[model samples]
Target: MKAVVFSRYGGPEVLEVRDVPEPKLGPESVLVDVRTVSVNPVDWQIAAGHLDSRFDVRFPVIPGWDVAGVVAEIGPTVTEFAVGDEVIGYVREDSIGRGTYAERVAAPLRTVARKPMNLGWEQAAAMPIAGLTAYQSLVRTLRVGPGDTVLIQAAAGGVGSFAVQIAVAMGARVIGSASDRNHDYLRQIGAEPVAYGPGLNECVRALTPQGVTAILDMYGGQTLTSSLDLLSDESKGRVVSLTNDGILEQGGTFVFARPSKADLDQLTRMAESGVLTPEISTVMDVTDAAEAFRLSQTGHVRGKIVLRVMGRLSAAIH
Candidate 1:
């Protein structure tokens, strides 16, 4: 198997494609021949050693989470899928190494879901992490619904794109924060766009003096503080965050994406029904992971950055 691995924590420059041992199959896992994978902030963060305190760093770490692939082999105890079944997964393990950034990966049954038929390989590969983040943030944590006005930070990015659509589908009025260029794009996704910057709180206030009934902060730092400041008294428990757990102290819910087959099924149903769609900003070959990581680390992409892992297609889109 060929995998992109970094022998030590460093920059994207440290990543290299090399032949490596195939992941050992488990009784509860399936071996997938990777078709596509998506680059996420956590992939580069773990590569750069930012998550050292939280997870043990293993040498030759394979950094990736989202995957869309065909099942090459299924474990003896895994009855949910069979050989050649199309699947998608959030292939996160307890440690940081051995991931989907390769030609193949052994994914646990718990993290895999049937690929949404409405999506292509690139689109399907882009869903798991960001889709789950948005699903958990709005449905599980924020409980957004009718008559509620929800404000979502980083509204044009991967998770925020999904969050905006899901909130709108749930009957919540969505106010999204993005750059001026993405404001129109946000409106197309059913969110009322607002420019995010030094005057974000004031701009939001101008939109609705009563303040937001719920807030989901996908971007941390300034956005987290701004989200806290924008929350109405009625939104005490309606606030959710994907990047900051500190929101819990302010009566908000801090969400870490969980691998749930049920959630994937729901997201699949929504996509099939035309209520949700993934916005992909870039696609590159698996061999181009270093460059893809560079683009993802910039934190300015409008949506997801995907790597086409299999097939004759080797491309990059900005």
Candidate 2:
């Protein structure tokens, strides 16, 4: 199989397309004939060794987690999906490498869900990690609901876009912070748009004087710290950060997205019902994954970036 691999930690320049052996399927996993893969910040962060302290890395790592494709083969113990089932997955493993940046990936059943029929392959691939993160943080952690005012940082990006739509669907009034270029986009996604920067708190307060009922922070450091005071007294502990662990010390929750088939299924339902739609900003061939990583590293993309796997395999008979 052909896959993108990086032998050492560095930048996107270190990535290369190469011929690698097929992934070994586990007893509870299915081998997917990958059609599309999406780029997440964590993918490049892993490649650049930013997550060295968290995950064990092996050399010649294939960096990707989000996949949308057809099942070519199912494991002996896997009964939830059979050959030819269309699926999407957040294919993260305990160790780094053996990822979805290839023609095929062995996806565990716990992380896999049927793809939303309403979404194309690229759109489906864009949903897993970002959608799950948003769903878990807003629905599971903050418990946002009707009458609540929710503030989402980086609301035009992958996770933030999902967060905005999900919160809105849950009856929360959402306020999203992004650049001027993305303000209109935020509005389209059912969020009241606010320009993020030096006066972000002031801008949010101007919309709701009492402060928001919940905050979802995708950008750490100053963006996370500065928004602490923007929460209502009753909602002071309703802040969740995807980027900052220090949020734990600040009486806020720090979320690391976990793969849950049930959560992915709920997102799929939302997509099929027209309540959730992934916004894809760019699509590149898997062979040009290096450029895709570079684009993700810029931190300015409005939505998800996807890599189309050329020459996808036909679903094989078991």
Provide the TM-score for each candidate, comma-separated. 0.95, 0.97
Question: Which segments of model 2 are wrong by more than 4 Å?
Answer: 312-318
> Residue 42 lDDT in model 1?
89
Using TM-score as the measure, the top candidate is 2
Candidate 2 is scored at a TM of: 0.97
Residue-wise C-alpha lDDT for candidate 1, range 1-318, written one tens digit per residue: 677789987888998877778799999999999999998888998988988988877788888989999999999999999999999999888888898888889999989999999899999998999999999889987778999899989999989999999999999999999999999999999999999888888889999888899888877777687667677875666778777778778777788799998999899999989999999999888778889889988889988999987742222210
Q: Which stretches of candidate 1 lie over 4 Å from their true place?
A: 311-318
RMSD of each: 2.7, 3.0
- Candidate 1 matches the true fold with a TM-score of 0.95
- Candidates' lDDT values, in order? 0.88, 0.92
Q: Write the per-residue lDDT of candidate 2 for residues 1-318, one digit (tens) a residue.
A: 788889999999998777788889999999999999999999999988999999899889998999999999999999999999999999999999898988899999999999999899999999999999999999998888999999999999999999999999999999999999998888888999999888888899899999999999988998788888988888888899999899999888999999999999999999999999999999988877889988998999988999888473221101
Kindly give the number of clashing pairs for every candidate.
0, 0
Best by lDDT: 2
